[model samples]
Target: MSSRRQYQREFVRTFFTSPTAVEGDDSAKMLRSASQLRGMQAPDAWIPDNEDATAPSMREEGVENIVEVVSEHGEEFPGEIHPRIVWHRDDPSTRYEGFQQMLRIADPEAGAVEHVDGFVIPEVGDIDDWKKADEFFTIIESEHGLEEGSLSMSVIVESGAAELALGDLREEMGNPSNNLERLFMLVDGEVDYTKDMRAMTPTGELPAWPELRHNTSRGASAAGLIAVDGPYDDIRNVEGYHARMEENRAKGMIGIWSLTPGQVVEANEGPLPPETERWLLDVGGSEVELDDVEGGQAYDGTELGLEELDEGMYRLEDGGEIHELDEEQLRERLVEMVSYVPSMDDIVDSMAEFEAAKEAGRGAIAMTQSATLVVDGIEVEISTDRMWDEATYQAAGTPIALFRDVHEHRPDQHDELKERYGPEVVERALDLDV
Candidate 1:
């Protein structure tokens, strides 16, 4: 293939993964949207013992601990905390360490094109320690060009003062600022019966902490600042991404759902929006179903042979001859498949038969690992390639192994190949773990 075509193919495959690649009117809008919905902030703290303060090796040990964090997560970026501090502080250090680690990962240089939508907190007291937190956030703001809504505080409403001040803190820090993004108040600690009941039942049911009640009387707070509140126990079920997605979507806040490999097919399989389907068809010239025809024998939920219904439309027939459908139904289905990106699961399922055939040495799946080849230092994924150059591999002294055959022979030749080509040239193949 020519370089231009190769570049075009790569551009499409890797396109949507980048934040900037998502549709937006302009750079400012993209950046703004990212700031509001995509940034992830985590806080960590480290507590040092009195004896450790005087120990000569304490600092070195601290550095090693930070190194472990980075090693597990990858390299830290410039302007982010030097990992040496993961173990350096006491009280608020763990939260601080996590914050730095997340920031390190968020740096573009670190290739963290995506952000964490969750906030991680290390302890309860540290969550309420604002003075110390202010100092830490100040350093963060100065080091990285963070926008408001990019970072949040995991507040712990342990003490009466903390609970009382939660609203105030939230109102103060809700919007974008030079110093920080946002604040989240998480209540964690031993709680009395009255406080628990009141927190759970709504504001008026139980007697409130005097300090907190007095603070509330003082004023109404702004949104976004110290926005996260509630009984810690109730919050547990809603902490993770799936629950948050549902909640956010209900609130009209879902822009994109970051999917794992398992969820991708289901996510993609969703009925496509009419406009999007039209756009994709116009742009990509994708195959469309023509009409409903008897799908030979029903071995599965799907009919074996699919019939195109119209331009960019297809229907599955289960032994029945073509039947006329209302225009509305046809338009709806046309809109669906055209816009639908199959869920990762469905997509994988759709390839099961082909992959099985490839494994059995019958034929290769058009766009899977079965169709990939390692060339030079890159992996040429040929699953999307319209035509295969079977002779090319035969000429290169490389055997045209079926997906299974390659695995069977991989261990024997892999080490030798790596030695001869240098690790970089064989890295892609090795990643297949065959």
Candidate 2:
């Protein structure tokens, strides 16, 4: 909270479909407000005078200002283009189209352009691919006479392979030889990740928590780059969206994408203080200051060494391999080793966040006593206290509807509700997923 805003690894995310060239000036004919950004370079870049008529200043009729959003979040989330990798695979030309979009997004010869700030690259699978991208952009910048770092870049990791290569990705980004910006981890990679693990349930939760936890921490912290997280997919699931952004914030991610305009409020929230913040103050194993020894391993003693092991990971060794731990595992062991009592304020804050999280997740399924609920005149025993057991799921009587949280309409089965509730109830029932 300073009078002058700080320039951290900032981001402001918004995306608009590049208007189809064939759609042209007539595209603005449907409009009240400008459908196109004036003064922005076209996604196809410079137009051939004979073939193209729309200028860099937008079609004259579409010249009225579009809505502008200012971020009160204090962190600048400047507008940027998201260059997707699928285009690269589909055809090289389309990928370049994305690049053209990036170039024109913010660069305006006239007045202030559309606040274009940077770019985020999606689905980087390996270091080789990353290096190629780095070089590609380097050349592109040179060609455009754009100074280095003028247009920033961030990469998203969503696939399982990309998940594993996160360490290498961060290491490469931090290598100084490369100019790749932040690495963001999308938590619910959904089917993209699940298809590899073959383990995702219908609810879209990745049971592999460590796969996610370490990705954000290692990428965001180790590489010292802005860590970005997923846009909580459900636009209407405000509680769930807030809870997720909080988790991302706790993991040190500076930003989360907004799936809808409303969800930007959740992404804008500052994180509650991180549970444990540490630095390798004593590099060569020296004694440091100490407070009341809490649950963490008191490290005031000498012989503590934090050194790089594999890329993107540091080992906390007490002089040798006899006791070595990575960041996440090390924290767990320290918690078990000591009961470092935090100040009452810290305790209160932690508990409050904990309860809020519990409320957000389990809050959907209200727990009450057993009751007979009739759906379409069919009586079914419904127990709010206990969800449907494995036996109940298998029994296959009248569709056992435990839809309090909308779990019954599994991702694969849409009409199951319609099949059970009949046309009348189906018409009247609230959309639980909403």
Candidate 3:
């Protein structure tokens, strides 16, 4: 098996901020916002966008804004700073312009180089193209007398060849001349990718391209890099944004591109475990939770094996004893029987218990979870037992791992996490080892 490079920080969210341009003699609004973002609480990594977000006529000015703002405020910012530079695989002049800008931004005397973590190369082609960009960073580092491989490279996959380039990374890992090891993130750029593929839709919107996301996730996992989804442009549709995030979460791609600070907050909190436990039931092939049903108005009493006792009442037999329930009580009980998602506290307790079990020479153990409710005057209970082995323990430790990473990178979020998860749970999570 080949060894994967270890990264020091977590990448839950990457916020892209475009450099501000002077408008009709007014001051730069976007540049002011970029400086103010040092106090914001979302992105784990910040990108001063100088490519697609900036107008061609103002790109040189945009580069200056990045240098000026980042040099002054990047130290106080909680996240890593990576400025997106212009690059085109087929265009020599554009590539050279980008190269020259990189040289200026990375110069030791510029004062931004010390705060800059790396550069984001956009519109890259294949593995050779990736190497070419990596070589540029290497030359820049050498020119400035900085440590080799000190500057990292993240590529935006906007073409079919760029999508396929991910698979070639594992084979090219052993090359010592280039800084492929410095590669950090594999970010998808869906809009340009759609144009590159010549794809079209009735609505003229970007396709979901789930295969691309899955491939990106798999490639990131195989190469030990972070996978990030492209931006969800429907900024005002907050629910739609979260729904998209849930989909990306299912594919193990926690990081995403944030176009606004609001989106950044959502993306930052999207990956962490829920604050409270939730239950769901399969109702006619659709999953329904307690929140889905409004006052039990839409539910019939027959769901989840509840025996209807009256027009608005029901009875449930818990191992033979009968307990009476009303419409609202019945709806609540039914949802709890089908599925359960553990909360952060629940995870910490389980991990702590599992550690104790392992120390006591046990390979596996059965853990029981129960839900109880009062019906009429009797207490009815529903319980579940899951066997936890080493594999299961490791799987449950993902949230803990993410928490530790956040705790390490963003000390500003420490009090917020403690307030959310409690100090005991936070401490235990930081101390946990897989």
The lDDT leader among the candidates is: 3
Name the regions of candidate 2 deviating beyond 4 angstroms. 1-7, 10-94, 103-114, 174-177, 181-191, 195-199, 202-210, 270-434
- Which consecutive 10 residues in model 3 have the weakest lDDT in total? 292-301
lDDT of 1: 0.30
Mind giving the per-residue lDDT tens digits that candidate 3 earns over 1-434?
11122258655555555554555553356765755663334477788778888778887887777778778887777777788889998997888888998998988788888888888899999999888888888888888988887888888899999999889989886687667998898899999999999999999888999988999988889888889999899989998989888898889888888888888887888788777776554555566553323222122233334456658678776444566888667646654545777889889889999999999999999998765433333334456689999999998988788878888878878887888878988887877776
What residue pairs are clashing in model 2?
Answer: 11-77, 12-77, 12-78, 294-339, 294-340, 295-338, 295-339, 295-340
lDDT accuracy of residue 211 in candidate 2: 49
Question: Using Cα atoms with residue i matched to residue i, what is each candidate's TM-score against the true structure?
Answer: 0.26, 0.43, 0.87
Better lDDT candidate (2, 3): 3
Q: What is the Cα-based lDDT of residue 153 in candidate 2? A: 56
Residue 170 in candidate 3 has what lDDT? 91
What is residue 323's positional error in candidate 1, in angstroms? Answer: 66
Of the pair 1 and 2, which is ahead by lDDT? 2
Model 2 weakest lDDT span, ten residues long: 42-51
* Residue pairs with backbone overlap in model 3: none
Q: RMSD for all candidates, in order, please.
A: 21.0, 22.7, 5.7
Model 3 root mean square deviation, Cα atoms: 5.7
Error of 3 at 278 (Å): 1.6
Number of backbone clashes in candidate 1: 42
TM-score for predicted model 2 compared with the true structure: 0.43
287-314: candidate 2 lDDT, tens digit per residue: 2333323332234444554454575455
lDDT of 1 at 135: 46
